[model samples]
Target: MPTCSAHAVVDLDVTGATISKHLYGHFAEHLGRCIYGGFWVGEDSSIPNEGGIRLDVVEALRALDVPNLRWPGGCFADAYHWRDGIGPKQDRPVMVNSLWGDVEENNHFGTHEFMALCELLGADPYINGNVGSGTVQEMSEWVEYLTRDGDSPMVRLRKANGRDAPWKVPFWGIGNEAWGCGGHMRAETYADLACRYATFLHNHDGNTLYRIAAGASDDDLTWTEALMKAVSCLGCTSRPRGLFQAISFHYYTFAGDGISKSPAIGFTDEQYYRTMVKAADIDRVIAAHSAVMDAYDPLRQVGLVCDEWGTWWEVEPGTNPRFLYQQNTLRDALVASLHFDIFHKHAARLRMANIAQTVNVLQAMILTDDEDRLVLTPTYHVFEMNKGHQDAVSVPVHLVEAAPAVTVGDQELDPLSVSASTKDGRALVSLSNLALDTDTTVRLDLRGRAITATRARILTADKPQSHNTPTAPDAVAPADFAVTTRPGAHGSTELTAVLPPHSFAIVELDLA
Candidate 1:
């Protein structure tokens, strides 16, 4: 456990890759109370909801400015039948959500409810179609019901259900984790099915559908290779375009052993370090998969979409075992900032990534209690602080000095995680100090970018495991960060800031 100062060299002039706003997307599944009690509490409840959706949760999510929301499932998407969930509230068939908690799904939150929720949050809808237990025609008709503008059976049924105008859903996931819960199909088999599903998926109201195929699980590059090859083979003789726009990948960072045994709260420093080590492993996974994708798509036309990802730990005490519920600690915030930096660096191929969920699930942004109570997690603050990096050009950051490694390992984990972006004469630099014990004061050298003024905000806790609860919601929140900048002796600008241990900060600079 040695201490070492870290330094970052940022070049504003040498910049490329515009970070897509969709990278800050979120996920909402029908698992647990994520829909029933979390976001949808019945309009008649005393929670002050709008159309059975919690207004407080909606306002909190709106504050995050969530770009896109993937709905109806992780594993639940494959088993879900859209038709069963639509129609009258009471008449809708109540089915068993066997994938989640074996809990009864009342089918109240159907397609109409989901699209309405998207509209309320001002986020684009990214729906996951059922490709395993459902048929191709069923999936096509569901898309037609939502996106089709012309008069058709599906559209007419949608109007009869209540909505006259069609909802614009640009992104569609052909399947989710096909190699796992979706179907457990082989790489080659899933690829062919994905291409076939995309064929019948029609565009409505001139809305171009961004069809995404189910991709690899962790380091399974063969899946990406087979899927891309299958998609590239489409229209080889007749046309020249690929069938899929992007491929989806799902990776979750589980603490302790890779199994489902680790607890969420009350963890030792060793467990915390191990969790971070797993989080950093995502960089390696992305690199390996991106290289495989390059073999099929040398032109890099198709984007890499991480539709499902986050920290998955054991369920909370006394909660449903199948419901993946856990408290979001400062450690979770560190994990999130680390991924954001990685996504920014790989913005060329990594266009969009959605955290596992937005509420009442693993590493959620907001958690709700029984009635009229909600608290924002530290991870939520991380997203709020780093939101400025959206749609900004990625600037290269070179480490001038090595950062101290975590006590758990000798390998350098890049304790000083840094990413920079510049847009409209403004530059933003996000830094995360992963050292759990020691704070590091670093010197920032902004190459070819003159800084006139600067401001910052930091999210940290007195302890590494500090988190917010319903009773004590303000336990961990962001405060105005103090940073110093002045003219260097060599006629260049130099910035210095002290990053507290296990903290994340965003520095905004006014460039001249």
Candidate 2:
């Protein structure tokens, strides 16, 4: 039997990074039911809807305070002709989603629909332009269509269709995954093409387009260097801040080879440990890429955008393989919490991260059935619980001899992971106990901040495979957490929390 008791001290005075709200962002591509049935069900559907979009989904997303939504594609954006999807639904062109699924894309939910949905959710829209198969003129016209306030052909067309006013699209991706599905082009070639497309992508309606060049996949430093160099050369004779403000990086956590990933539920303990290790690799990826960016832009003028991330598992049993839909479980919640902790720790280099998807897709926050029933997955609760870390000043914490490692075969993994933030006289601490059999008692010493009140919300289960289904939707959900506290000798508050195995928790403290 292993006794899982850990002692750690957190200093309130030690603070550095300011966690951007965008770190809690989400991604929605034109893939699977993520767009069609998952979000857009048409105004006449039997399901309760608001302007063709599901009102239930909208309200659920609003609860997360979803910061930004990347749209038009994952691989779909590059081949997507925005013009085809923008007009009367009857007149819209039908196209095939070649990369995602071989199914037909009924251009019903196009530019206007996406922007409208964003407005309803109060989330910013991050559009990925088609640089792979699209021309510079096409990209320019698309931006002009959505954002141009002055008189223009695209604007005239937009007005004739419906919307009288132009929308403000702040974040723009020159291309997505240029090293792979985007174009299969080398770094230098893609960089040149990105510069050309970004050149014609102008600022519209007093809205500065924050252009992001397609960036590295994993630790491919050359990709980062080449893109940075290209942008730097363009910046020398161009504006002081140049065109591209950020670089996009895409990383997905799947341990198995190729598309054959681990199962979504009921995996061995060793398999679970390996999955957690792969999830934590984002920190290393960000650090390596940031160092390359630092070499070129030492002022950290450009930030890193983890536009595509999340666990990709084998599709749900009998569904279309290309749909990329998988059930969310406690493992996913832990993985999400780990990524958020890493993102919060590296807030300086990382400005934003949009999980691979939002609904009915890879590691989705919400899962829906054919009967219009919705289940808030374990990952959803993690985001809802840790939402306070958004835009909050990140308080650094050091774990001192807290607990031993969980040894599985040749791998060693820490049992406790934590991240702290301070906002409005409140200290928010997010924790994860990563062991499979032991529940660790974490003794927290709030060094500089005095606690007046404390409350915690935890997402856990009796088993690692515990999850929500339509039949049992509340199988693994958040519940009130109780902690023991006492006044320490040095006028510090000592708090003791029992973190169960494979659980994620958010502890909030009101400071006096």
Candidate 3:
């Protein structure tokens, strides 16, 4: 049993504001129906779409205020050739997807369709270029086609294909997951390629182009070190930025849970503990990634974007395995909420992150079947619940000691997650009780500031594996939180809220 003061205050020393808008960012890949049927359903169909893009799905993502979207692929980005997917859909060449399901791509959704989707959702388009299968000339032309104003091959192609104006895609990636799917190149090799690819990238003034270097996999500190050191010193003449706006990292929560990894929660102690352990590791990965950046450039310059992250369990069996879709439960909700806290706590260097998907792909925010849709996954509720964290400045907190490390399989976790902030003079305390069971309560004490109403919203399910399917849409969802009165307690308050077996709750306090 470990205990200490849970008292804390908003220190004015931390001036950096947390970029909350980014937490709502999402990932869109060329996998399965994620892009073709899931997002781009074609204008000719009677499925009620906006010029081929699913209108209802668009509306749902819009509601979440999705700020940015990474496109052209996940691993697919590595092999993607922008030219093949542009010009004319009829003329666009069809290719086989070697990385994902080995499916045949019809080239139906191209630059115009992706750009159009970005416009409709009011999100920034972050395009991952094909470093493994594409050349420097190809990457350069793709950027010019979208961001360049005057005549260029890409611009001319855009006009000839259909559109006449530039789409202004400011965010571009030199490569994606290069170490794995992009290309199994040494960090040294990838670093040189990044410089070369970024050299040809050009965007109009007022529109900054971010050329992200493909970063390391989980715990690959050496990879980050090698890339950071190589790029910081290897300056390019044409592009002075030298491919250093940000470095992209991809990670998945796969602890060998296998087909047994049903819902994110509701497991034997082994299952619950394993899921939480993986979720807790997020902070460590961020810290290590930031540390590597710090060593290279002591001054905070290169940002770390965990561009892709989500639980990857066996596809819910009989369904198309390529969908990469799974059930989102309370455990999943907590995983998402906790990750938000992790990134928010390290906002200075960890600038951007996107859940593996937005809809019907991986740990999606929204799931759809035909015309019917349900927020479905607790992940959706978690994002909606933690909306307060979007763009809010980070506030420091001193957490009292907790029971020593909780072990799950071969690993251990901190069990307690906390991230706090004050925006527009309002204080928000986001807590994720990573503990599997036996409530671990915190007697929150605000020494410097006075708090008024402590309103709370929670996403909790009775069992860790609890989930919502199309048939029973309301299985696990966010419910009104019951806050307790102070009773006879003076100059103090308490809210004894059950955190569900494995769930996340956001507590908002109106401080006077």
lDDT of 2 by residue, 330-429 (tens): 9889999999999998999899999989999998988888899999999999999999999999987878767788775676678789999999999999
The digit string of per-residue lDDT tens for model 3 on 1-512 reads 33322322334235465755765678998886678767877888777888789897787777677788999778888777777777657887889986777899988887788888999999999888888888888888777777767776666777887887677676787888778778888888888888778777776635679778888888788778777776664332232245658887877775456432554333566766776777778788989888777766666677788888887776665677766766676677777887888888888888788898877777877777655454557788787777777787777766554534676667777666777777776777776666656455544544445567778876776676778888877788877776453522445444444444355777787767
Model 1, range 144-240, lDDT digits (tens) per residue?
9998897999989999999899889999999889898999999999988998999999888887899999898888888888887775643233322
Supply every candidate's count of residue pairs whose N, Cα or C atoms clash at under 3 angstroms: 0, 0, 11
Q: Candidate 1: minimum summed lDDT over ten consecutive residues — where?
A: 233-242
Give me the runs in candidate 2 sitting further than 4 Å from their true place.
Answer: 233-241, 256-259
lDDT at 269 for candidate 1?
80
Clashing pairs in 2: none
Arrange candidates, best TM-score first. 2, 1, 3
Instruction: Identify the superior model by TM-score, candidate 1 or candidate 3.
Output: 1
Off-target runs (Cα >4 Å) in candidate 1 are 1-3, 233-240, 407-411, 489-491
RMSD of every candidate to native, in Å, equals 2.1, 2.0, 3.7
* Runs of candidate 3 exceeding 4 Å displacement: 1-17, 233-241, 256-267, 370-375, 401-405, 409-411, 484-498
